[model samples]
Target: MSKVFRSLLLITALSSVSQWAQAGNYWKATAKDGWLDGYVEATLLLNGNLDATSIDTDVDNGVVTLRGKVETDTDKALVQELVLGVDGVNGIENMLTVFSPGENEDSAIQRKLTDKKVATVVKTRLLVAPDIGSTKIDVNSSQGVVVLEGQVKNDAEKQRAVEIAKKITDVEQVVNKLTVSD
Candidate 1:
């Protein structure tokens, strides 16, 4: 009976220690995430190209979520790029929308904005696609036409890139100038 009581106490102590260790880890992760959030916000504020006033940033376990509107798609992509450069940023969920107030959709300015948005979207999709070397590809858009240029690892990759660009809304045509690499 005495030995059984001692064993029970030992087990309870071990369980308590395990719980404390887990709680400590949680607090450490939370603190790290908070630090990363501040760093990301400061980085955005310091960038001249970004209007950080309209942006909202949140960080969780090293992942950052950006919610807001930007003047152009270039600005949206730029935000993600800048945040990704921050130390400890594991990933990003970019929810930025391109918006220009008081502009008519049919107007030339609006058309240019749409074109830029299409280009940015295509470039981002290519960058995220599996097995695609997006760094080697240059994406451009003008008047609803998208041009893909650069070297691809194989013909299949070239075809995949063209298909991805073509599927994007507002992309009326996809001109593939991708060379198959040796």
Candidate 2:
């Protein structure tokens, strides 16, 4: 090969290597975000004061986003503090809203009943679906929001569960926390 061709080939090889290195870094950052999400979830599950089902966490590029409702302001603060303890979490955006205290007893009861009904309907749909094994899944609903927590065999099962829940009437949102088994 001529000198010019040899130098051009060397430059092309270096460019390819640089691209691969950048891709690897991107993958590592993504994996770190996933790990942080899992850590926050597990911590919430273990906490006695915070209801894990009522809180959802998402992490992207090390920034954590907390969404959902809590019963009290103290619970909201507690969740924020607990999430800050997780390593690799660059920051937390706490979007948790406290349940309003102005509601009367009758309204609260009605809302509870409606939520229960929604949960029951979602569960029934999941049980009847041909692809989903409803035995391993748990469903909860509050204020038209459905929360699904359980382990499934694969990604297909997880997506099926979420779709089933979303199909239920009165279900305003579906928070899927389903895990795939190894």
Top TM-score: which candidate number? 1
Q: How does model 1 fare in lDDT? A: 0.82
1-182, model 2: which lDDT tens digit per residue?
A: 69999999999999999999999999998888888889889877876545779899999988899999987554565677667656677899999987853243477775675676567656655765688764789999999899999899899999989987886666799999999988
Question: Residue 10 in model 2: shift from native, Å?
Answer: 1.3
Q: How well is each residue in 82-131 modelled by candidate 1, as lDDT tens digits? A: 67757689999998877964343457876776677678667766876786
RMSD of 1: 5.7
Clashing residue pair totals per candidate (backbone < 3 A): 0, 0
Least lDDT summed over 10 consecutive residues: which range in candidate 2? 100-109
Q: Which pairs of residues collide in candidate 2?
A: none
Candidate 1 error regions (>4 Å): 1-8, 24-54, 61-69, 72-106, 124-130, 166-173
